[model samples]
Target: MRINVLQHTPNEGPGSIATWAELHGHALFTYHPYQFGQLPTAVETDMLIILGGPMSPNDDLPWIKAERVLIQDLLARDVPMFGACYGAQQITKALGYPVSKAPTKEVGWVPVYRQSSVIPNLPDNLNVLHWHEEMFEIPTEATWLFASAAVRNQGFVLNHRVVGLQFHVEPRQNNVREMVVNDFPYIKGSVLNQTAEDILRVTVSGKNERALFAILDYIIE
Candidate 1:
């Protein structure tokens, strides 16, 4: 299978997703729309993974708009897609739902509770990394998957093929370090936000990676 990834920043890449793809013998490709301004068409994408970013989906950038259009096209064709954070917001916006400011800027390791049993093997609650100021609204047709105390809409699943997570489940240790280093300024002194030292101090466990892989497998199945 040809798995295409849409990355918005250099810091945010397909961490464990790439590993999962390699283990499954699938080809993985990444496109940096922020830098190269190119995206894969639906025909070329067997599975689409949209990574997180610092930008908002409401931004008036040309590439953001183009990516939303591509998302809409892919949705029309029933292409399996997995979106993280900003990518999740983009998918919600593309589906004609609203993406608004979250109650608070959640940036750290937070616990998200599983609200639906659509995807198996997910624990009732898991501490996943989060870095977002805005949240995506669950579409009327989508099943509410997960929720955290800080954000009500932590994740959603649509059509049993598209999944959107408002947290960072694909980040490895190095990926988290890069995110903490590059987007350090975004982390403020909030009740939900964690300090750089604290975020870095916590080890990146294999549980999150397994959860991410499970979601990916569920989407493609």
Candidate 2:
């Protein structure tokens, strides 16, 4: 299976998802949106991944609008898609669902709990890194899979194939380092309360990667 990754920014990446994909022997393709060109071809993808970015889905940029159209078509095709953070928000908008500011921004390692355990494979508490200002409302037609203490709708699944996660499951060292650096500007005042290094030190080490791989494994297979 070919796993195509849609990256809306230079810094965000597949992280531990890459490790899992390589281990599963699936071809990984990445569409870097910042490259300034048409979206990459997806004719070969058995699954699609819409990665996280700092930009809002409501941004008026042409690329953002174009991506919305493309994502809508992908939904029409019913291709298996897994989205993270901003990507999840984008999917929410494209699906005619609502997304709004959460009561507060959730950053660093937050505890996401299994809502109902219908999947029968997830844990009661999952500590995952989050970096998003917005949150999604579970589409009326979809089933919510997880909820974090910081946000009510952490993730949702559509038809057991398309899934959206509001947290970063990619716990690779590079992902953590890059996010800390590039995301600093958005986290300015919050830094006074808690340093990025301190947050990283606490959140970076955990079994989150294994749980993330399990989600991907379940989705792709």
Model 1, position 211: C-alpha lDDT score? 90
Q: How many clashes in each candidate? A: 0, 0
lDDT of each: 0.92, 0.77
Best-matching candidate per TM-score: 1
Model 1 compared with the native: what TM-score?
0.98
- For candidate 1, write residues 122-218 as lDDT tens digits: 8888888998889999999999999999789999999989999999899999999999999888889555757999899989878898898889999
Model 2 C-alpha lDDT per residue in residues 101-138, reported as the tens digit of each score: 87677777667887755454677777777787788888
Task: Show model 2 residue runs off by greater than 4 Å.
Answer: 189-193, 203-206
How many Å off is the CA of 196 in candidate 1? 0.3
State in Å the error of residue 204, model 2: 3.1
Q: lDDT at 55 for candidate 2?
A: 83
Candidate 2: residue 6 lDDT (0-100)? 84
Using Cα atoms with residue i matched to residue i, what is each candidate's TM-score against the true structure?
0.98, 0.91
